[model samples]
Target: MIVSLIVIVVIGIWLMSMYNGLITLRNNVANALRQIDVQLKRRHDLIPNLVSAVKGEMKFEQETLEKVVQARAAAMSVKPGNMKDLAAKEGELTAALGRLMMLKESYPSLKANEEVNKLMEELTHTENQIGFSRQFYNDICTKFNTKQQVFPTNIFASMLGFKPEELWELPADSPERENVKVDLSF
Candidate 1:
């Protein structure tokens, strides 16, 4: 009877350890995702400033400016925790912003505007940060998902209700996936 009690206690301890590990992994994934959101917030905030700064210079580029605004609106509307929708919206915004930025080369006034230059620099930096955060988020998500699928933990993970996270991948046909066609015929 004593042996049975000891075995039960050991199993209980092991189960608790597994549960804690899963929680830690889950939290790490959440933290990484939040980092992406932080960077994205910076980008979203800068878009209007950049758009306004260049609006007067890119007089013929109203379509591009409109696209950026619409994309930003769509991106900002996505609820947190919906990574799939968020990624898609963010990807669209990125493409629109990229197209807008490239037009700076076409418009000499935009290139000369100090405000536009500063905002563009800040937006570039924020994009780099967002890229790093996304990579980290994906890495953490992979570890969390792998942990729940391996060894003895596998048997208990689903029983404990853990789910795999969605990774931020650009859709195969996304404009961001295409090679940027730069025109230098100014």
Candidate 2:
């Protein structure tokens, strides 16, 4: 009876440990996503400054500017916790930004503007940071997902209401995936 009692206690402790580990992974994923959100917000805030700086110079490219503004608005409208929608909107914004940047080839004066150049640089840096944060979030999510799908933990995970997270992925044919061709013939 004593041996049976010890076995039961050991199993209980193991189960608790698994549950705690899953919770930590879940929290890590949330933290990572928050990092992405911060970077994205920075990018969104920088867009207006960038648009204002380039507006006067790129008068003929009004459509391009409009697209960028629209995309930014769409991206900002997505609610937090909706990663799938966020990713889709973000991809659209990226494509719009790409088109806006490409206009540099047609408008040499805009590209040469120091303020515009600085804002573009800041936006690029923020984009990279967002990418890294998304990667970290996906990594943690994968670990958590695997833990929840595997043997003994799988049994308890469902009981505890753990669900897999959606990864931030661009669609296969998204223009955002294409290389941005910059014309440096200035």
Q: Which segments of candidate 2 are over 4 A away from where they belong? A: 178-186
lDDT of each: 0.89, 0.86
Error of 2 at 21 (Å): 0.2
Model 1 TM-score on a 0 to 1 scale: 0.88
TM-scores, all models, native as reference: 0.88, 0.88
Query: Tens digits of per-residue lDDT for model 2 on 25-118?
Result: 9999888888989988998998999989888888888999999999999999998778778888888898898788777657777677787878
Q: Please write out the lDDT profile of model 1 over residues 1-186, one tens digit for every residue.
A: 999999999999999999999999999998898899999999999888888888877889899999999999999999988877888889989999898878777677777878888898998899889999999999999999999989999999999999988888987777778799866685
Clashing pairs in 2: none
lDDT of 1: 0.89
Clashes of each: 0, 0
